[model samples]
Target: MIVQHNIMALNSYNRLGTNNNAVQKNLEKLSSGYRINRAGDDAAGLAISEKMRAQITGLERAQLNAKDGISLVQTAEGALTEVHSMLNRLVELGVESANGIYQATDRDKIQAEVNQITEEIDRISKSTNFNGIKLLDGSLGSSTANVDGGSAITATQTDATQAQYVGANAVLNGVTFASLTKGDVLTVTVNTRINGTDSAQTFSLTYNPDKHTQLSDLQDALNAQIKEAFGADFKVTDNTQVLTFEAKEAGADKAIVSGMSWTVKNYNDSASGVVVATGSTSMTETKGVDAYTTVSGFDGGATALTKTSSSADVEKNTLTINGQKFVMVKDKDAAANVNKIDSGINVIVAKDLDQAAADIEKATGIKVAVDGNNLKVFAPKGAASGGAGLTLQVGDTADSFNKVTVSVDNMSSAGLGVNGLTVTDQGIAADSITRVKSAIEKVSVNRGRLGALQNRLEHTLNNLATTTENMTNAESRIRDTDMAQEMMAFTKNNVLVQAAQSMLAQANQQPQQVLQLLR
Candidate 1:
């Protein structure tokens, strides 16, 4: 045996080192409670676990985002509840005023209350917020169609006209009353000016052929009835087989006749009445339009022109912009009609093209200017700030349905259709009633939408939680060490290390044996 070259000892020494290294590795796995403590231990497993960790973190954050979304929906819905209540109150007032029992003074008091409610509604819409973000100002998602800007339009009232006629008076007007028998009832509605505002009153007359066979008797009966009911002097005159009713006073403020209607009821056969000539008239009070200019470098710009007396001619006008259509209708408080587009854009009717351009700018963030009888609309310069609509990201992934967009519209009195409600007379009050009801419906719809979104977010949160739990479990399987199994491995490695040490000592002794032989 050569002292310098001891092959057996060398082999045993290498085995000892190998076993010692394995023992340390097993110790690490047990102490750390992870199958792969480092990349050197399991490179592929580390990569996979890290990916799972990222997904888990993302899911956690997404859940938080969903919670925030629910909070926002709740905030908006709460404000809308108040709006709903106000609309109900407005409807109540409207119905009361339409009964014609209240005088002009009483109606005015009711109108004041309505106006206050409207203003409050507008205030709530403008101020309602979640985390300082306006909720009901149509910033979420908005669409628009053909619409342009114009001056502020005022309210207009239609001219008075004779709507119906009955009795022997009908015969004088070349129409025969075939069923003017006993117990026949005739209803007459008179629209007149009272206290500088429009008012209406109705009178019912029961026909008794035995008591009212002569035309003179019929005229006297009608005169006495009119004087008592309306507190006004009026005479019905006949000229060449034609009948005309005129107020005794003569002047603009002399309770001029606005409209007249008559209806026959409780007749054996069909009652006959003739409608006199229809009257069409309107009065406008102008509020100047605000102007708007276009931002440079805007594509898809549009031009709008304002038309005079002819401008208010259209009962309803439609505008198509960016594949969206906006319908414009006359507003009592505006000089021209206005349209609220689904895209959060507003179209204002103006007296002229310049006024339209101005009004458009004031209403929409978009800028516009008159381009020869046409108003041009353009996007504002720089990124849309302040007025940019709401954007909600609901998922970690960039996919459809992961994002929700909503356009919260203005919820003010004007937006709710009660901005210019008037209760001066039965006709006007009746119109107000219809408008108030419509506002109530709008508020209901908005509330429903918000509630639905809240529910969807709740479901989203649950899904995220489940996904996180399952993924965490998968990650644990890949990364966590089974303590019992690791302990067994550690014990086996410990025994092998001791055995290798003992063998190492024996192998070193063999090298000493060579020295003994040399001695």
Candidate 2:
């Protein structure tokens, strides 16, 4: 009966507030369509949902990255396709030039086309880019050169001497100099072997009947031409009636004159100037070059170059030159093995000291000449002084994403092993055919690698998509609210709130009874 203490009304009011708060929460959830809109709604669910959302977003981004990777690969492959076609055409041209029916002028025309194609290949290699990133340039792959630790040899020089003829009565190689006229041109083709391959250079000497052109004058002119074309690689010397041409640098790698032929064109009295000596007949192989090292310096027998170790320590014993590492290994036969060098370079450690020296010279483009039991090693002529070798590193981790790296090598003519290709003569053309074939194989292999990378990226993209979809679904389950269920809850809470308000009113009326008693 106390009007001051309305406990029943107070309880009804508290219950009304609870029902109203519940109804408000239901309305919020229904409007937002999220069960866990904030941390207070569902702390544990919110945490899990946020983690899933992060994963979904990451997966989506990763898929995009993979697609980009695919596009890059496709771009590279397309460029290589053109390269493949051009290589095929080059092969055809090389074969065409090999026939005997084609004259020197015709061969020259074909060579011009070949040169143009080579330039085009280089242009493509330099220009082909994916998003401004060079694709076919040699920067992507490891440029490595393996040096052999065989018997170091000194430089050797082979000389070709020509007997000089001066007076009208004198004859050289069955050809009288008196028969030559002022306008007569002697075309000399010098064939040189570089890196186990033959390359030729043609030079013309114009005979002047007015100047009385001695053999010394001709020698000086030829030497100047050689110096200009080869950059100090060869020289010519003349004494009295003897004229000699020699490679400036000693060793097997030196550009030695393999063959030389001279044809007197537009000459007066062709029968009188018929040159007899031809095709390296005037050249003689000389021995006894200066040796820089003794046979005792090597580990194996004094005569043979052998490995010090029983097995190859590819990880340990390595020489890094020009950012490229050259690995030396021991063969099973206890011989010093240099087989790991590039296939283009033939470095074999043979029992014969001369053969071993030759092999080293051919492989490294360096001169190796034997001095008795000792061997001497000299750099190739015109080689850059203090030039560092190439370098290659494995397992580099500088990229942004975790991925397996694919190495794409240089796609230029030199990189493809077609540099300095000669399709002029039948012999040279035959050799060039083999070289072009090898180039084609290299391109094919590179294209195959690109295709493989593209396929792998496609798979990665698919996987990323699946992971993103699944994670998104999981996040939706944790965060999204069922509108239908929430609406039902809202209806129930609204009814409860209304009932609480009515009960609160009735409870207040009960307090009015005490007032009535007082009246």
Candidate 3:
């Protein structure tokens, strides 16, 4: 044996070091309870596990977000419940005022209560919030105005007349009513052109069976209403129980005839008054037009022209994009309004628009898209911030598909039209009753919308919880150390380390004996 180097001892010494390293690694994995403790352990697994851990964390946070969204919806809905109660109280007071037995002072007292209730409604709408984010107060509302409302707007426009309804304007057609009945209410629409624009004037004749039993009686009553409304310019005749209007002007086309259209309504169910429908053309042959309101000032000190009221057209909300000006019009009554819109100058107050931008582009060729926001420029719902509207992040990533958008309109007194309700007079009190009823409906509808949002968030939360649980399980499979398998490996390595140490000592002794032999 050579004293310079003991080859056997060297091999055993190297084996000891290898076994000790194995034991250390095994202990570490056991202590840490992770198969991928470091990059060296499992490079691919470490990367995958880390990514999955992030996803799990994100899912957990998303669940919390959904819960928060639900809480926000609840807060708004709860405030609306109080508003509903106040509206009901207003309805009660209005009904009481209608009783002629109540003196003017009593009516005054009812009006005071109404004013207070309206003020309280305004307070609740402005103050209701979740984590400092306003829920109602119109701050969270989309740019779309609910002037006519969704219920008023049809989801699908089937025909040209339906299309007219969509735009809230249509060409008036002349109609001769046939098969007149006792309970028929006829609407006489006359649209006269001034400066190439049709100004519409309408009068309605409600037929009572006791008063207007004959076709002549109905015809004469319409004549009387028209004479007062239209200046005795058109002549009406009931030939074989059919009413038609003729213009006194010599050069006017009989087709136009000032566009007199009679819409028949059978208010009484028992009374059979089926009016035959007839169609004619207007002087300009005007069609229906689309209307829209603009919200602008979306960038670097750009002034935002936000709509102050849904119904009130007093405030003009103009959007100037790329130097193209959009003007808000109160009256979308003319069919030329669509053509006016294409010129990029005419903007009208949109009413009863469900698909705010979609419907306008379909029937009318008006592209109603604006970018950016100002202080009043709220982000549109489901869209990224920089505009007005609330977006809830319900997903792990920045993908827009992972977010939820919420829209809540202003529920103030003026917003609901209950602010101007007065019961100081019987006739006004009777009108106030109708206004309060409408306000109650608005509150109920708002509550329903909030409830729907709460339900959606609840569903989102459940989905997140399930997704997080599954993802965590997958991550655990990849990253967690299996106790039984790891413990067995540890035991085997520990034994090998001890055996290596003993063998290393034996091999070193062999070298020591070489020195003894030399001596």
User: Considering only N, C-alpha and C atoms within 3 Å, which residue pairs clash in candidate 3?
Assistant: 298-373, 377-388, 378-387, 378-388, 379-387, 379-388, 379-389, 382-405
TM-scores for candidates 1 onward, in order? 0.55, 0.54, 0.56
Point out where model 1 deviates above 4 Å: 145-389, 515-519
Q: In terms of lDDT, which candidate is strongest? A: 3
Q: What are the per-residue Cα lDDT tens digits for candidate 2 across 124-236? A: 98898877877776556432111111111211111111111000000111123454455544333333323223344545544454455444455566566666555554455
Question: lDDT scores for all predictions?
Answer: 0.53, 0.53, 0.55
On a 0 to 100 scale, what is the lDDT of residue 292 in model 2?
Answer: 21
Q: TM-score ranking from best to worst?
A: 3, 1, 2
* Error of model 1, residue 224, in angstroms: 63
How well does candidate 3 score on lDDT at residue 38? 83
For all candidates, the clash counts are 34, 15, 8
Query: Local error of candidate 3 at 206, Å?
Result: 42
Q: Write the per-residue lDDT of candidate 1 for residues 219-338, one digit (tens) a residue.
A: 455566656665556667755433454446534443333332221212222222211111212211111112112111111111221231223222223232221222232332332222
